[model samples]
Target: MRLWLESAVAGTPSWCLYNAVLSVLRATSALIISLLGVSMHGACVSAAGGRLNSRQRFLGSIVVAWALVPVPGRPQDLSRVEQLYEEAQSARTRGDFATAERLYIEVIRRAPELANAYHNLGIVYFMQRKYEGAAEVLEQAIRLDSKLGPAHAMLGLAYYELYRPEKAAKELQAALRLNPSDTNVLIYLGKAELQERDYKAAAKTFEKVAALKPRDPEILYDLSLAYMKLMLESIGRLGEAAPGSHQFWLLLAQDAEARGDEEAAIRNYQQALRVKPDVIGAHYGLGSAYAKIGKYDDAAQEFKKELQISPDDWLALWKLGELALRTDPDQARQYLARAVSLDPDFPQAVLAYGRALARAGKTEKAMEQFQRVVTLAPEEDSVHYHLAHAFRRLGREEEARKELTRFEELAKKKDERTQQMARRLIEMTRAAQPLADEPEPGFSPSRDPTHH
Candidate 1:
């Protein structure tokens, strides 16, 4: 029996059970259960056969001079155990949970080293709504084999149901470490973090789940709550130093916009303006948020407001010109030209000015600005498109064709790249699905313990 377990240990990774249970190595613990203890589920019993042999005595490299092995069970007993295990499973599957529980307990008593028995019994306890019982035995299974990721995950869920967030978090962490792709463990860990009021931790957990499940409304909702809580806490800390300052309201607006609360961002931006009528960037931020929701007219007005105080602000001029282009090409040319004059390197403003010139039938001047745009942003497909139109306006047919063909090629490549990114995101969600790490199947109780 001892030689059999030794051979089993030899066949398995040397540190498999040792590191799985204790997570460390030491001399004394290594001595008593080094081989059999490689698996905590293996037998630790010692006797004459378990004692050290002549080779070890001669080598003088042995501690307690004892070999360890799993307790030998008879073939008939092992056969009966398998039958009982199957019966328990069948009973549990059909909701005869009471009978299942009794049968599982008997199996465990006969084969205490069987981690599967403990794990299945834990499941039966869970089905019976006996959460405490489930936690207790699930932990035993983990103790027997810490590599049992499903046991850890199930234990975490049981702890969550019992309102033990700290324990739940710990077990979920263990499960995740063992199986990082387990979606259930991720969800439970996020919940445990939320219940503990560790919003930052919750956000981290939920964000990973969200990345894995981009369309999951519940994960998104929880993530938003965490973001809001953390932001509020930060705002509170800031408010402590400077209460009701214009900067406070401006910061609030920026935070709201970052969290995707456009309405709140607008409100905070407005409040900033009310607190200090000339608060810098308040109008610009409000305009940006308005633009996000397609309120172009409102956005234009806000940009105009920004220019009232900072008349030479090229960004405000450029934004005002871009917004005006849809409704007032003439107005767009005036602001855009001024914006380009103020900052020649502003590609967007230069492009808008070119477009405005084209709209006003100044094809020659439009060509100059479009050529400058090409120099500044040579790889921009839209620039090529606008330049092609400029060539057409000037009646340069061959040049127009060349530019249009390049535009189409760039656009196609851009579209393919975009589609590739979308496919990657979709594939990410599929890989997020949980996978169970099943044990290898060679070891069995029915295999002759004395065969070695």
Candidate 2:
């Protein structure tokens, strides 16, 4: 190749030089094949040349040959671009960012339309936490190759890091369209939906993720947070729509419930229903208050009403299952099973369903449910206690003992956390306002009333 360049300096035409180089390359390939005792057509540059096969040998030789010679006036020197890309990737793997950046930038300069080069350079910028720079390069990559899913993904992440959720969502949706089963794209889409306060959309998106990777606490937690925010936003919107209607009173009852005023909350919720019998959320709020006060029968009725109004309410189903657990295992099993089927990752509903399964003499099935509960909510003491009981019932003494020990440890930690939280609440209350002027009247004396 160097000799060909020397001849070029002696007034050889570029086309003639290119033909001479091609002839020399073919001669070298034929000589090497003969010397290595391998067929020139089916070679792999290995011992006896039985390794990488024809396609690999062909591509490998092309890469080597391209690195040794510069092809001018071509649309793209793909071999040179791929070789540089491989070198950049090697440098990136070793965390040599400077080398990677330089090589990738050079690849882009040589092949200005190389999407992979721009994509990798964007990743290098992202690794350095330069989100703005990543966005710029990744956008260019997307322009070069609209089907480049990874470029869209990186651009979405960059936009997210730059606090541009709408753009992030758009780019993530594009990426997800290209690569439908990507968990990272789904997670980031959920995050963008959440940041935009599209709670229902976020919950639905996270539900797909939860189904894909069950027992992932982070996904479950995000789903739960979305549900909670959706609930709060619903109430807030209801109040905004009807300032003095039954919905507004229902909001007040919810506030009362939040303040631990179960009896008053129940009364307020009842009044709300009386004001507007078909009011949304009133029945559920009343049911929750009744459940808080241990009025299981009353709670069950209210939940039944809510379920009639909204047939797919998993929370209503869960409450009904809880109300029937001690009295009717068959009925509890039906409700809890349906609740679990509706929202399979729901930890509390799963715990209740496990208890019902145990009552129905399905010991192994009960154990499975309890184990799922542990996976879903390892911090919950009730699941551990019930699981220990389930293990004992199955005569798994060692497993039972382990669960009991875990339960004890978790209970102690939970108690300490509760105490700390209580103290913090008291301090916050003291700092919020003076003692509420000795507490408002008509508050129930037994907020945590024991079941009769």
Candidate 3:
């Protein structure tokens, strides 16, 4: 019986030997049974008998089913799909986005239900700046595998890039539900909120992200921007109460300037400066503000102070040069030249330098500067017009005619009022002669009549 039990436990094919041992044991039954009952060995036999009976019945049924069940008799072939997926992953890991995209597409074609292939394909589209394509691909991935949290998160990013903040919010919210602790998802949701112009929502989302990633400077910067927006909105509402209040005055000045009320803007800017002398923005603002009012000396003074604080401030230099143009051409040229030297790439500076040189009778150099302006800003009609004028001054009639034709083409596309002004200017330029022949009006004849 002991041999039979051992054979059963071991699953050995020794049933004949086990049965012989059992028969021997049963022949000495009186002595063995007396010993088994006297010892704890009988309990072990009872437990083993119960366990073995159940196991033997279960094994017998499985064997019977195995005999009846049909087998394909061949190994399943998934090698093609497996190979393509491996190649896709390898290409993705190697940063060969084009190859990765192709491989992922092939995988999807072979197995359309592959959620991973869709997800990776979305990532490849995002790398290529195809945000709309990424959003579509990621949506398919989400449909195939609802539990794919990262796919939903990437879909949110794609939607945000495509300026579909509403869709982005939904996808990102879903991602957060799937993985509440994902810090990157939290940050993305915050950015989506910002794009939606829901400043309070953005602030709240960012605060949660900041709690998780305390030292992240980009998160802090975004938080600051949201707060700043809220503050500016509040300030805007408050500005309506006290018209002459310093903050209110500044707001009014900015609003007036934006609306093209130059005189009103200048007055408010002056008032704001009187209330607060050390406002850097006000000082810079006042310079342009005074220039609008034709207060060149005052404009020059304010711009000089701005330059003292910020020596390389190009806008201030430009404004000062423009102010000097009306009253002092030599002074204007000096400032404009200084501005060009400070920022070689400033298109406005180049245009202004060309104009100043033209006014100062440096026709050759002025033509070169105007040509440079046209090269830098070919689409700018003003630059083209200026170039035409410079060419006309230099006796380059064909070049001048070509530029004027280009200017007319551009002007025709403009509004009625601008086109009218351009037409008047073109007529004036055509009528005008060289500087040497056109002396300043109201100059007195020499006091010695003999010389005249």
Candidate 4:
């Protein structure tokens, strides 16, 4: 049994587990049981097990270990054990883990079958960072009461700390099956999945957490990282299977666009179009990149080509409408009206339509569109800016002033948000860079227990 547990720990990558669990353990104490301790007899029993592939020997040892626990003979002794258990619970709550550990040992000695005592003991061992002890006790706890979800979760966390991701994932999954809404367990399981390189499963797990806490930056970051890993895997396979294909160029263009390399994006997107002119997104991507570089005529031509391929593309129509607003307001309105009708909930299209209406000398209609944009995106600075202009044109001075003030406030906040995002991007890039002292590829260093 000892050999099996050590092998399990040795099989996992320690660095991977360290990175996976460090971010998650911040809220671990709050998520786990309040009462906890480790059983002395269980620890002593699992201390030595050299027999490998001998289930009969392991089972016999377990039976002997169980037989060694002292069970009380009277009801009064049982009541005394309950009193001692309560004292251990108090000690654990007060952070006196030593006293709690001692009292819990006494409780287990009196009532050997009490799974909660073992479960609580596992929690104490976990808190003390004695993960081997924690795993042993938690396993016993689970064996005694298979339905104990907390025990399962605690055991999984211990396995994670011991660098046993496969076992950790299994136990964490079991815990989730018993309580699907346990977000902390879900987080641990997601990290374990990530360590295992199961990117799709990790993404799904993080998505569930995102659904529950939509604004959590850590959860969002994990989900994005998982998706980025999945994208890299897919891109690798695509490159191996279809080198220099139009799809490959299109993917590269989209990646360049996301990285804000508009010039590279335009080049790749054009290559995609040259390879397969009828590809769905190639023209639009090329046009967008062209627009970013101030080539409006080129952008307009590409947008028209995109429309030729997909006549009902609302995004293409919206781009054309935006490009025409500076030169031909009436033509802009024509294109934007169709775009807005196709996707009325889109704030950018509605805002552009309002701008075109204002330029066409239709102030009332423009004001209506601006109001609608505000409802669709109240926090959007440009929407408020356009609404302010509409109000000023209508001689509503006070309302225009209010809208301008709101626009200024939102613009400031938007600038701060952009700066924050830039900082986060830098941090993420730094995290992905190879370490200065990293070993060469294909090199394997001897395991260092002190690394944990």
Candidate 5:
């Protein structure tokens, strides 16, 4: 029975376990033969046979002789942990933010020390517009990996969104310290400084960004705005009695107009133009501002002056078209057509041309212009709504309804102006009525309203 058990153990598939059992049997037999005072050569032969049959017998004999054997430690199972982390990363890449967040939470629960999971989860929260939740998760990430620059940067962004500018500044500064060349961090720091009204610091930050990205128009525009703001603030500190004060005020006006501060900005621009009639930007700025304030006649005169200086100024032509639209649709069409001829991709010119056609009751032609706008920028809900109205006027009820539905869906993601236009379009299309009950005193409808 003992021999049978030994043979069975030796023949097992697990060679290491089989060898272990053989080593035990051989050691016991060798000890028994030594105590019996029999010739040990036969016992040594039996042990040699066991060693020849077993893989680990030689190593086990050496270990037993030295009394120095290593005990195997427990194998770690990381399969579940690995699977959760992988799922979290995959979900985030696909923009499935909710699922990504849940998976990240699971990973954190299973492996509390996984800093990357917390960081990624925070990013998902940020993408979902959950600023407070993002802040919390990112804060935890920072605790786990205090030196992680990305976590600091993200925490800064979250704090900025939460109206915690002071904390945002600290985190952003830390991120910058870790990666001084990060343009995005620099831009955020500048924005945070601007929020804190630290214009000087903001200017310095933006200057660094501008240095890194010299030809970026947006950065230049922002830098220009900051300079203009500083100039205005400087002038505001001085009373009118300050020497050369007119020049200061004119400079302030030019800067304000450049930044789109229409009314006061226009006054300053006009002042600058009056003081130096050859100032081109001042003339353009004054004309554009006049058009914005609905002073069309004044705008037309200013634009004419601008054209005298720069005959091919497309902006002047577009502004003239916008001014003409309120009074003369035909003339507006002419100016807008000129602007389009100069720059076919001009969105403002396209919009104005569509408005001109609509106002003139040329609904079909109006629709062509609006359709062009949608083709040029499908994201523009106003263009869709305008096209819908044109379709309704042209008696294409189904197309009009389709465009109106599309406009509403797009409008839900729109700003105030576009939303208002979409709502007006919806009301008009649903009521199936004209905007006006009677034609204006001298103007006549180009087509019968009842026909549509």
Candidate 6:
């Protein structure tokens, strides 16, 4: 029975190592029942009794079907082993670890080469938190059937529980190669990589998980942690490589901007420009910081300086154009035209250019740009709003009304999306509340590996 079951399962088209464990179990059960009689055990058949059942009872069907597959050379001994294996599975499911352990050991004694028996025993040990025993049996399962992805995944998890991150990562990676879509294995691999201080690898692994589950707050949080760790690691390396350099100050300025410290960002940007007068982003960063603080004149001057340094800077052109819209329509048109010419696909720039055209009393030309904006951003409420205003200016009242209605619908959906995002953030905060009492970990630049 053991040999027959193994051959039936292991022979499944290309061995199907990438299949989920449940699918393999189901297929093996179905094939065994189809090829051999269903009533190998009268009790199992009577219990099944052609009635609908829960998943637990459905899983029990494997036991009934497995006992019927003929074994070579030792039919009597193998039938006893099969019965014991089924009993072990039942005990494991019932949470009777002691009985399950004894039955599995007896099954192993009769069928020493049954890799799935070892795998099941490993699962039982794992369920009991006996990581050492689980690891031992899982290793044996892998030795017997090297392509057993579930065993590899379980062994990796066991190794992780044992605090052997290097081994865990290796086995988890092996499992992922066999079953690339296994998010659980990917998660464990990412954690193991993080524990090994391989921030880059951890970030890459977590990014894959995030792609697979974009809306999962937990995965997204872990991905953010990985990216934060990777950033800190790079910052530590950068400090060691070029302390007090313009690039270092530039990085600090950008970090300050992201943290909403406009004053600090301005100071750092100035320092960076002082260090390297022609640095690519220093003028632009300073201009943005000034604009954030409502210093329009200073922002314009800084943006002009950036244009002088990099003549085709589309962002600088767009910012300059936007600033001029309320003051000088002619200057705004020139800047916006150049900005649009440089980056035609930039929806924000295009939208701003349309506004500039509208302010210049070129309603027809403005409508053309609005059409382009609509094509570029059909779902954008602002796009529809501007289009509706243009329609009103053209005296197309019905079209204007339709556009306004579409704008309101889109705006409501946008608000709902924003509310949903806020709810997700709140949920994430609640999930993290238990750790609020924990002391926050500090990063020490001096402890960086790159530091002397």
Per-residue lDDT tens digits for candidate 4, residues 135-160, read 99899989988988878888998998
Candidate 4 residue runs with Cα over 4 Å from true position? 1-117, 177-181, 326-346, 375-381, 394-413, 416-452
Give the clashing residue pairs of candidate 2, or none. none
Give me the runs in candidate 2 sitting further than 4 Å from their true place: 1-83, 252-452
User: In model 1, which regions exceed 4 Å deviation?
Assistant: 1-76, 90-99, 127-130, 180-184, 206-225, 239-243, 251-267, 286-305, 308-312, 323-331, 338-351, 364-391, 396-452
Q: Give the Cα lDDT of each candidate.
A: 0.73, 0.74, 0.71, 0.74, 0.70, 0.74
Q: Kindly state the number of residue pairs that clash in model 6.
A: 0
For each candidate, give its TM-score against the true structure.
0.58, 0.48, 0.45, 0.63, 0.46, 0.68
Tens digits of lDDT, candidate 2, 31-81: 665554454444455655356667656666764454455454332555666
Q: Across residues 1-452, which tens digit of lDDT does each residue of candidate 1 receive?
A: 12221121101122235334433324454654554323234333334446445554333333333233223321226667778888887787677989989998998877777777888888778767799999999999898889888788889878988999999999999989988977767987999998888999999999999999999998899999888888788889889988888888888888788779999999999998999998768888889899989999899889898889888978889888877877799989999999999989767778789888988999889889878877876655666656666676677878877876666555555656543433443234235432232111111233211100
Question: Whole-model lDDT, candidate 1?
Answer: 0.73
Q: lDDT tens string, model 6, 1-452?
A: 12221222221122124235445766777665644335545333323355434553465566664544533222245456667877887787677988988988887777776787888888778778899999999899899889998788889988988999999999999988998977788988989988888888988988898888899998888788888888878878898999889988888888898789999999999998888999986888898889989999999999999999899998899889878976897999999999999989876678778888877888889889878877866655655655666787788878877776666565555556543443443344335342112111112223211100
| TM-score, prediction 1 | 0.58
Which residue pairs collide, candidate 6? none
Best by TM-score: 6
The TM-score obtained by model 3 is 0.45
